[model samples]
Target: MSRVIIRLLLTLLFLCPILAHSQLEDIDLKELVAGAQEWAEENLDTNVLDALPELDRQKAQKFLRDLQKQFQGEYVINLAALRETANTILPLLESHEETRPYAVWLRPRLDYLKIADEFLITIPPPKVEPGEPAKPIPNPGPIQQRAVWIKEVERRPWPPAASNHVARLKTVFIAEKVPPELVWLAEVESSFDARARSPVGAAGLFQLMPDTAKRFGLSLWPRDQRLQPEPSARASAQYLKLLYERFKDWRLALAAYNSGEGTVQKLLERRNARSFDDIAVYLPAETQMFVPKIEAVLLRREGIKLAGLVTPRD
Candidate 1:
């Protein structure tokens, strides 16, 4: 078995019970395995898959079953193992142009995995009562995560790609009547790599999803306009401006940007909440971390708080 297969198998074995207990009991495990196998066969390079020594079919099935779960799990601790897997897979993904976009997706997210690992090591778990039913260990809240990212982002030098792209991208955002400082969003989304693409179909420096790109008048066919820096930045700025108009707060607008507007809206209505912090805990773990990470990035790169950002006056 390839080391990737072995590691995934171990992770699936270790996390299956935890996953089953945590709201995923209704999922059909075999179906998930089949789906992953199908995706790998279709989308991944045949040569790359062949290079990974084959595992027994049953073992491969078992390992692949929870592969997505391991990456998307709500728990931060689960991410520690994936950091190694991502490191191993990155070079392989970069080896082929056909798969390089997936590498772009994974590269920016590696820091997230690293930070989650450090979060597990550095932050002590919450205390439980002696006789209380054990509960999932909660991830650090937005304020705590902001502090963590402040330290994490401060130590790193600016991404080299940012120097080449930020000026041009800022001009696009300004033309769209959005704050130029918000152009740093590309740093958080794609490290200013215009070629960046998410596995789920988001693309370009702004990482605009097809639906959002289309809604903003960008074309998906005859070439994905999302991969074009200027067009995508214009779309992104328009979307962000619309999100801000809906939410009225930069933090809430950003939370909507990451998690979807309906998600933030539903949570707000459900909780009778208006602020991001009020509904932050109920949001997906990724979005919970995302807004603060953006805030931290803005502060580090521009010396501006999220609240300090202002859309350009017409």
Candidate 2:
């Protein structure tokens, strides 16, 4: 047999007798590790020391330190550190069958260390480098940036391509006893596309379906007046006003607009909810994201309005 295997056999032979005579929990764990290491190191130069590189020896040494930390007072396992150190050691040892057995023997001891930790709060591993890699900074995602950017855009004090239509709808919204700013709904609904027609038959700047347009006094007989910006904005605004009256919350009203009033109302009643967020979980995928989309656009419009008030810096 290879010298490493003979060494491992001798080490285990020594440890196995001690292990059998004493329960692992009852014995001093440090002694258990020290005894194993002392046996592994004894007569080192005379045995397989030439076959085992210094790097492998260093890994074993670190493992000894790790074992001390893991089984010492207030015993705890640093799982992440244990895993990382194991990664470093396993590859070096597993190339040879004799050394592989050491890893096999060590696995149970590693598991035993975890069993000893009293809580999630582990003893931090000794610092190996300057700063930890995973900490120090966090990066935002596109969706998060989209939400923030959209709100900041709303505060700009200038009108956009869609603003003229919003101005036209002011009288319409006022006539419907709704907030004029809500005309931004049309921009989100149809992108102010007066000729906008959905595959589902929703049309105009407001995206009102034929039946909805008919109820609001629009005609499709002569021509689909649902395609007219003026009348459609009036209809869209009136619908918003109607929804606000029913739900008594503008955000929920907007969610109703996106998800269908009946659907939203049922979710609210089923959930015993009064806020959009509470019922939002049950909303359709489009509606789930649509409300925030509208708010982003609305906030951008608000930004434009506010930006207009700021005097030129230069």
Candidate 3:
């Protein structure tokens, strides 16, 4: 009897903790990642946790810490909030519960992550600080101005001679991985006038609308540099490059450039187009014509000499 009672006591003691833990509901990596994805998509600006790499989870945690430090007065963390934060951040990289269809607790959180991801994609990369030792600048000889200007002239855009400035602008863009076709957009939108203004409050040679400019963290101060022919061209090119990384298709990227990425993404969700021409018509009218015009000019310029024309080299 004594031996049996001892054995029973030992079993109960071991089972007690296990039963308690089970009652409390244990969360693990799988649960955390799912909860995070759902929560982030629903609440924050975008699901920053998703587009960024999985190895960066520690960094994301650090970011949260930094945020906590920066705004100590504004935010506080509790158990529930920590669970929510984990849910919002983790699934962005890891999806563990492949078989489980749904976690009722995690669904609401993923909604916010979706929105956060949307906004995050639009945010430009941080700029390198000035006063870092300057790198040697390479000199690109000659401007592709006439090609840029004549296209503007054809559209009856002001500043008829503006296309002549393309060669000068080309130098800045050549080093960057920007598509050459985008240079013509500057001409069509702003007439190569650094101080160009549009009826809808688009400014700069690139005609970046104020909201679009702001989204890139561009400041509208005494004068928006985005309107400046050279700077605006660079900004536009960089923006396009970023879009290309997101969509992988130049046409879809261009559509995202003209319209918002959200718009392009929605269309992609709808038409699921395989090529630019397939989805080009779905873009805004001006954007619809935008790609073709740029293509036409670029093709003509590249093959002008082949076409038996005296295309001058700058």
Sorted on lDDT, best first, the list reads 1, 2, 3
Best by lDDT: 1
Off by over 4 Å in 1: 1-73, 128-133
Model 1, span 89-203: residue lDDT tens? 7776576554566577668778777887887787787788999876766777778888988988986778888888788888888888888999888888898887776544466
lDDT of 1: 0.68
Work out candidate 2's RMSD over C-alphas.
27.6
Question: Candidate 1: deviation at residue 9, Å?
Answer: 29
Residue by residue across 1-314, what tens digits does model 2's lDDT show?
Answer: 56766656443332222211101223332354446434333312222222457777666555644543333222222322465576566566556544553443343233233322322332233444667554311122224433544644455454244766777777777777777667777766666656443322355666676656666777765466776777887777677777777988776877666546766676677789888767653554334444655666666665332112221122
Best by TM-score: 1
Local error of candidate 3 at residue 18 (angstroms): 58
Whose TM-score is higher: candidate 1's or candidate 2's? 1
